[model samples]
Target: MWTTGAEQVEQAVAECVELLGAVTGRDWEGVRAGRLEWSCRRTAVHIAEDLIAYAGQLAGREQESYAPFELVLEEGAGNADALRVIGTTGALLAAAVRTTPREVRAFHPYPFRSANREGFAAMGVAEVLLHTHDVAEGLGLAYEPAPGLCDFVLTRIFPHVRPGESPWRTLLWATGRGELPGRPPVAGWRWSNNLVLGTERLTLQGVTPAAAADLAAVGDGGFAWIEGGPVEGTRVGAGLVHQQYEDGVHLPEWGMYVLVRREDGRAIGAMGFHGVPDAQGRVEVGYDLVEGARGRGHATEALVALSRWALDRPQVRTVVANVERGNTPSQNVLARAGFARVAEDPGHLAYELREPGEG
Candidate 1:
């Protein structure tokens, strides 16, 4: 799955070209009638423009948030200039991806910019796969994606699918289907009711360092006499402390914070948490620790602390964590932290803990 930028660029360019060729071979009437909705002509133009816009963003030329679609839609379909824009964008993207550094900062479709090469490639792949299908289907042609590319699309786009939702339905929903599932309904965009996609629950929470005690306690790994150990302010194993901030920085929105300390004042280890939150005031909990700090009872202490902090607030009533199947170390840690094993997911496990006072 580790691919070079040059390789990705070639793949993306080829996919775009194929879509254009497919469009040329198709008739345009039924498409114009909403049978497939817009004609293959509109489909090709959209693909080309999308590629050009992405390229411009990568090159730091145009702001990524500029919506060429809405602009073209307002400008009326079949505008010759749109094709030129599309052609230019595709070329630019193909060139940039091969040469840009992974860490280079560039604006993305949202108001913000991405800070690395992976983000850009991900954005590119998403566009090529999504629009290629759009053109193929609009022209009434059967187009099969390369196996690897489809897998990549599934990873990026499938997590957006909720239980009981069809991936096909989700695709339609994503591409302006009825009320878009798995995403907040945008005012102007009607989601497609035919695909399998819906909003998923990802209750997250934010807590201060002192409040993470319940999560920290589980790191003890069965060793006694090491309660309340010093939190590692630096790396002890694969996990980073303060000094290793960069390594974990990529996980900006999601990652764990640790607390460590022993009764004897030596640092035992740390723990982590992962949860989802919304306006409804609910959050789940997750925790982890490094190898050396295991068996010292630190994880239990941290869990208690974090749990107490979360429960005291009117907002949070439950915390949840998932462990891999057969990962006894993690399952044991969760148990010691007061979480009861609840269920299994594919190859992992799930546990839940109610706030101390919750019934």
Candidate 2:
């Protein structure tokens, strides 16, 4: 996914340059970029600005606010010069994406405060594709990016939007550039990054669809793990998340999360919900740790943070977990996390945590 993303930066820039080069003699400053209030020239510069900024984030591993510099063009620059800048910045972003480790997330102030390499790539591609369309619309030129590019961005970033038959059209609609038949007009929007939760010593990183795919295929899901870590259960959980993405019903915030130790960035375990919250505001939870990392209360710590996060949401009133009958350690972890034994089946015991005021 990372390789494809970087390759796409090159392709998208090439297409945009070719399309806009055909009309360099025209007055870009006088024409508005599609529905945006900014002129076509300004929009073109915005594209270059975003590309370079994303590159800086990845290259610098910016964790908090944005990097403290902007990409301002030289004096006497024209549409042609802007296009050249776009090409250069696009290449820079591609290089950054290629070199940045998959687990490295940087500042991207969308709904979430950070984004991984794939997320940055998808956002970069979207910027190139959409702005090119806007410039083309203003210049009276035709523009349509590849369907696969649109699909890549949609699946990676716009997880909440229902897909349409046409990926380009759907992507255009997602960014408020066009329309889909069944959906309402989007007047306000924010691209969602994967949610990250911090505990006293760990950060629970949400697994994206791309990461989930890699994890399901016996990959590390881009995490550095503890000894004998990312056990079988993590792989199985990743498979389920990947399947949910394929089915287009995966709520990104409800998917699996890897618990990474803050001191060393080594992943200790995985934990998450079975699915989205039910109508009755109930959801199932599960967790597992590496054999060497067991009995250290990592699971208990993660469960408490995750359970609190879940119950704090309006749609979740209870979180439940099912443990094998003989797994005393697991049961103890749940008890430590404030989950009461709720019920028992033939082979397992059910534990639950209700919102304090509810019961």
Candidate 3:
């Protein structure tokens, strides 16, 4: 799988600068960016601001809220000066992304409250690409980033949005900048960062489509796995995730999550719902741990945390699981996680953990 990193950030910034550089003589302050209230000049500054702000979040390790700072250009700064600032700030963000550890996540208020390095990198690329387009439209200049750059942003951050005929156009449509054939006009939109849930000893990190594709292809999915991980079952689950994403029905919160040890930050297993809740508010879950990491309560701990999270949602009345009748260890994990066996077949026993007082 292709990964987003400092290089992508640098590439996006380069594309933005190259496109806007040719139009510096134009009246940027007087012209409004495409469909936005801000002028082209203001939009350019916003791109630089977002780049540095994201860098600060990761470098400073600020949690719970944004850092108390902003990027301000000097008075009488020209378009050339703004471009220089953009270049400098883009480099800073790239450096931060390059240095940040894979497991480290910082505050970002999207659908989720935090984002990892890849998430931040994708966001940086997105700001540059989208704002450049706005400025290009305002200046009457043609602009389009590389399709791979757009794909990087989409697979990582826009997992819920369906892939359209063109990734760039789909990105435009998703951001409410343009329209697509089958999809309605987007009146309001926000890019999603994958969900991360914390347990006492584990952090259940939602797997993005990018990561899922990698995992399904026998890759690490950008995770630092313990020995003998992520096992065959995890790979199979990842394949299902990518398939759902391809079909455009995958919901980030309902997708797979890697169970990472809080103590060491190494992935030991995977766990998540088979799909969204049914009409009766029931959802099926499955999980497996790496051979080297099993039998030490990691699976049970993750299951309890994940099941509780699912049960807490108003739409979920019951969390279900099916284990082969011969798999005593797997059965015990579900039981310890509060799942009561609800049914049996010739090949499997079904378990369900219900919301409190639910029959």
TM-score of each: 0.45, 0.88, 0.98
Highest-TM-score candidate: 3
Listed per candidate, the RMSD to the true structure in angstroms reads 13.7, 2.7, 0.9
Score candidate 2 by TM-score against the native. 0.88
What is the C-alpha lDDT profile of model 1 across 1-359, one tens digit per residue? 24424355457657556555534534543465223366656655656656655565666634345434332443544433444455556566767766664324455533123323434554566666566566666655665556555433332322223312443344444455335434654334211110111112111122111112222343422122144443342123213211122221212222343343322323344334343344555566555444566776656666666666556667666777777798887788778878887788789998878866555
Sequence-dependent TM-score of model 3 = 0.98
- Index of the highest-lDDT prediction: 3
The CA root-mean-square deviation of candidate 3, after full C-alpha superposition on the true structure, stands at 0.9
Query: What's the lDDT for candidate 2?
Result: 0.88
Regions of candidate 2 where Cα sits further than 4 Å from its true position: 1-4, 60-64, 101-103, 224-229
Per-residue C-alpha lDDT of model 2 across residues 1-359, encoded as one tens digit per residue: 23437887788888888889889789999999989899999999999999999999999999998999999999999889999999999999999989987568899998888998878988999899999999899888889988878877877787666667999998888788788887778888877778989899888989877677778888887788888978999999999988887776898899999998888889988999989999999999999998888878788989999999999999999999999999999999999899999899899999999998888
| Cα distance off (Å), candidate 1, residue 29 | 7.6
Report the candidate with higher TM-score, 1 versus 2: 2
Ranking of predictions according to TM-score: 3, 2, 1
